[model samples]
Target: MKPGEFAGKTAVITGAGRGIGEALAKTLCREGMHVVAGDIKKESVERWKESFPEQEILAVSCDVTKAEDCEALVQTALDRFGQLDYVISNAGILHSGAVDEIDPAVWKQVIEVNLYGTFHMIRAAAPVMKAQRHGVIVSMNSKSGKKGSYKSSAYAASKFGALGLVQSAALELAEYQVRVNAICPGNLMDSPLWTEGENALGIQYARNRGITTEECRAMYDRQVPLGRTCRYEDISNVLLFLLSDDSGYITGQALNVTGGFEMR
Candidate 1:
């Protein structure tokens, strides 16, 4: 983006505590936009205040699974910035297992967060964007949304539903000058979602495939036509375009940044 192109604009982001969400929040804040960053963890959100006192950021405790919390987040952005120019729905969770083996509750939790959470966010922000008559809404989707993964039924289902939401919301909000879209990233191997914690996607995929983690990573890398995994910068670049005037004519697209994986 041009220097200060987004300056003075305001944005709201969900799941701003870590990984892609945190990176997105930092990017906007650095671009001189007022960002209301919301995370489920109180301590995680609080860090934003201490980290970027010079930037305008309202870090709020939010659980996207709840509509009230979602509404509160949008209201916070309006109360602080007077107008909301962008809303990035980045909050999501993943759990992979066969339909017969995975606990029903575990499968349901993924849907609740990745799917229901997105619905709540859109339901809360759409009205405001409609009222303002101009806004950009981007959802952090994945290639799994387009095709089913071997054992990631829940994750794929949530994302597929999210795509429907993005498209339908685009149609509903387009008349009001609100653009709604989704970015389907291939995979950020280095991201905490894949690498960190005991329940990381990397570990789950490796286990389900009967391969070592490194082997699983290598397999995915080789599958990408780009011969590499997706990166945060790749996603952020697409996101910036979707938020800019250059893409003012684009809406309801689930643009693929998958190195041709999704196309295949």
Candidate 2:
């Protein structure tokens, strides 16, 4: 799409406090779209609000796992921007553990945040998009959603369910001119999701494999044909296309942005 096509548009993005969500919000705002940046952490949201002009972004403390919070996010977009033109369901958590060894509670938490969270966002945004008879929805899926991963049952399962949800939602919302799709990104090594701390996937995977996080990162980098890990801009570019008028004919599909790491 042209640079100005997104100007004056409004988008609601969950998990927008950091990582890929933050990247997307920044990119969209730079392109002139008003953004509602929602995150579970109040401080993160405040940071985002302070980063941009008040007219360009609205940062809200939101937990996508809660239906009410999801509703409030969309309402904030409408109240502040006067319309909601796009929804990006980027809120998710990662857990790496063998199916047999992982606690059921952990599995439940992953599903609750990743799968149910996507559902809540969609549930709240669908009516608004349908009423307007125009909108786009993009969910941040993962390569694991399309293929099996070592010691990633919980994360994979949640992403798999999320993809299915996007497919069904696409079919249901097609008549309303609201397109729903997903972007399955490869490893984003620089993101907090991988580099944060003990809870980070890289650290967890390294522990499970009896290796160093750096070693694990190198292994993944080699797996990608591009010889590098995914950057926030890589996913953001694809998301921009999916949400723009350029991809108006696309829907009910999960596009891969994995540097050819996954091809089926």
Candidate 3:
């Protein structure tokens, strides 16, 4: 599609500091949409502002886990652009722990950030979208959400919660012409949720499989039929469609952007 399909549209994307979120923001901006990008990291927010100074993009500091922050994010979008056309709840975190070994604290953190975070964004954005009588919402999910994983108790649970939220919101928002859907990506190479923090999980995965850390990483990639990890654009392309008129009839569905990894 040519750029500017969203020329007069305004959008808000949470957890847009880096990776897939960043990719989505850039794609929307390139498409001529006014974008408000939110992230928990101050540095990342500032960096985005500097990187795309020419685009109609605003970078805001926000913690998706907090209701107040979510409200503020919506307000910022409306205040700056006058209306919200698209809302993407892309903020999330991952915690790798076996069902028996996972700590409650870690489990709660995942739920708070992934599940509750998506709820807060949707709850706040829906009213504005309904009032306007036209809007699109896309939530970031995972292949794990559709299937089980070896050490993804918290992550999977959070994503499953997202599916429920999408369905409920779709039913309620239909009359207002606000469509809600989800994008489930698999094995992205550079998502902080997967590659950052908690080195212990990788070590544990290797130990469980009786292999090296390198082998564990390799094993994960080998499972993908594409024979390589996905880049953020691989997921962004699907998201762009879901947000555009191309997906006008799609709602309450979690489209898989996995590299043939999770066949339904």
Candidate 4:
């Protein structure tokens, strides 16, 4: 994006405490946009605020699964910045298990956060954007949304729902000049989403497959034609385009940043 292309703009981003969400907050702030960063972890959101002492950043404790919290987040953006130009529904959770072995509650939690959360945010932001007659909404989907994964049924199901939500929202909001899109990223090895705990993808996959995490990582890396996993910056860059006027004509599309992992 041009240096000040987003100056004076404001955005509300979910899951801004870590991973791609954190990267998006920092990038947008540096590019001259005010950001309302929301995360379920209050402490993490506080830390994010501390890091941006000089920028216009509002850290909110938000549970996106709750519609009220989603509304509060959008209200805070308008209260602080007076206008909302973008909504980045980056909040999501991952779960991996065989359909029969997975706890029903686990499946529900994944859907609540990954799919319903997107719905709540968009539902709240849509009216505001529609009234203003201009805005952009981008959700963080996954390559699995386009195809099946070995043990990612729940996560993929939620993402597939989210992509559908994006398409439907795009069609409804386009007449008001609001564009909606989803970004499907492949495995991001360095992200907190995969490296956070024993349950994380790398460690979990390693244990399930009887290999070291390093070996698991190497195996997955070999699957990508680019021979590398995605980076937070890579997804954030696509977000920058979708939010900018450069991609004004694009809407209702699920764009892939998967390094040729899933060509569809």
Candidate 5:
């Protein structure tokens, strides 16, 4: 992005506590945007407050599953910055298990956090953007959104629904100049989302595929034509474009950053 292009602009980002959300928050902050970073975890948001004192970032406690909390997140941004330039719906969750093995509640939880959460934020922010007649909203989607995930049916379903929401919302908000789009990123093997915890996705995938974690990780790497896992910078570069006037004519697109792992 050009220097000062997003300077002085205000953005509200969900799931800002860790992983891709945290990475995106750092990128926007470095670009001189006022960031209202939120997460369901209060401690995570507090950590953000302590970590980025020099930057114009406001940490908020937001649970995307709750409509009221989503509204409050937007309200806080408007109250503090007075205008919302961007909304990044990056908060999401996933679980991997066979169709019959996974509990119904767990499946619903994924939908709630990944799909309903996106709706809540868009619903909350749409009016504000409409009133202003300008704004951009980007949802952190996944390549699973384009195809099914191995042993992760719930996650794929949620992302599929989110892409649908992005398209429908884009059409509805187009007259107001409020763009809605999604980023369908490939597997981010190095991200904490897949690498952390004993029950990390890498481990789960390996178990499901009857292989070792390293083998499972290597298998995915080979699937990508680029021969590498997705990177935070890859998504950020596309994000910067989506948030900039360079992509002003684009909306409702679920851009695939999959390195040819998925194509339709």
Candidate 6:
């Protein structure tokens, strides 16, 4: 779609504190849309508010894991813009470990944050969109959702559940002019979600396989036929398309932005 088509539109993006969520929010704001940027951390929301003081952006703290917080997120958008045009269920967390050794608490935490978080966001937005009879919902899934990983039982399962939500919600919301879809990306660099613990996990894997950290990273790229890793912009391009009227015909589909890492 041409730029500024979203000028008067309003968007609600969960997990907008950092990484892909932050990038998506900035892009939409640049496109002239009023944005309700929600994150669990009040500081992160405040940081965004300060960074883009010129734009019509509302920053709020929202924990997607809580149903009430999800309700407040939708309310914030309506209170600010008087309507909602798009919703991005982008809040997520990752926990990687072998199935046998993974702690139950860790597994439950991943599901709660990633899977249930998506559900809560959608549940809160559906009624608002249905009442208006027009809306778009884009979910941030992962390539791991498409296939199992060596040591990512919880992470993979959570993402898989997210895709399920995307597909099911798409079918149910279609008649209401509410489009729902998902984007599955592979290993993004410099994302806030990739904590030092994740790095250590990679390093440990590298050591076990007798390869350097660089090699380990490269090994991941090699899995993708595209012969390269994806950057933040790569994912953003897809999200922009999905949110725009250009993708109005698209729904109930999960687009892969994984550089051919996982093909259907």
Say which candidate scores most in lDDT: 5
How many clashes in candidate 6?
Answer: 0
Query: Which tens-of-lDDT digit does each residue in 42-79 have in candidate 2?
Result: 57866766666645677788998899999999999998
Best-fitting candidate, measured by TM-score?
4
Task: Compute the lDDT for candidate 4.
Answer: 0.92
Model 4: how far residue 260 lies from native, Å: 1.0
Quote the lDDT for 168 in model 6.
Answer: 96
TM-score of each: 0.95, 0.96, 0.92, 0.98, 0.96, 0.93
All candidates in order of TM-score, best leading: 4, 5, 2, 1, 6, 3
Let me know the TM-score candidate 6 reaches against the reference structure: 0.93
Clashes found in each candidate (C-alpha, N, C closer than 3 A):
0, 0, 0, 0, 0, 0
Show the lowest summed lDDT stretch of 10 residues, model 3.
Answer: 189-198
**Model 3 reaches what TM-score against the true structure?**
0.92
2 or 6, greater by TM-score: 2
Q: After superposition, how far is residue 126 of candidate 4 from its true place, in Å?
A: 0.5
Residue 229 in model 3: shift from native, Å?
1.4
Clashes of 3: 0
Give the Cα-based TM-score of candidate 5 against the true structure.
0.96
RMSD of 3: 2.0
**Tens-digit per-residue lDDT, 1-264, candidate 1:** 466789999999999998899888888887788999999985776765577879768889999999999999999989988999999999999888898999999999999999999999999999999999999999999999999987789999999999999999999999999999999999999999999998888898898789999999999899998999998889888989999888999999999999988872
Q: Regarding lDDT, does 2 or 6 come out ahead?
A: 2
Per-residue lDDT tens digits for candidate 4, residues 108-132, read 9999999999999999999999999
* lDDT tens readout by residue for model 3, 30-94: 77889899999846866866767787678888999999999999999889889999999999887
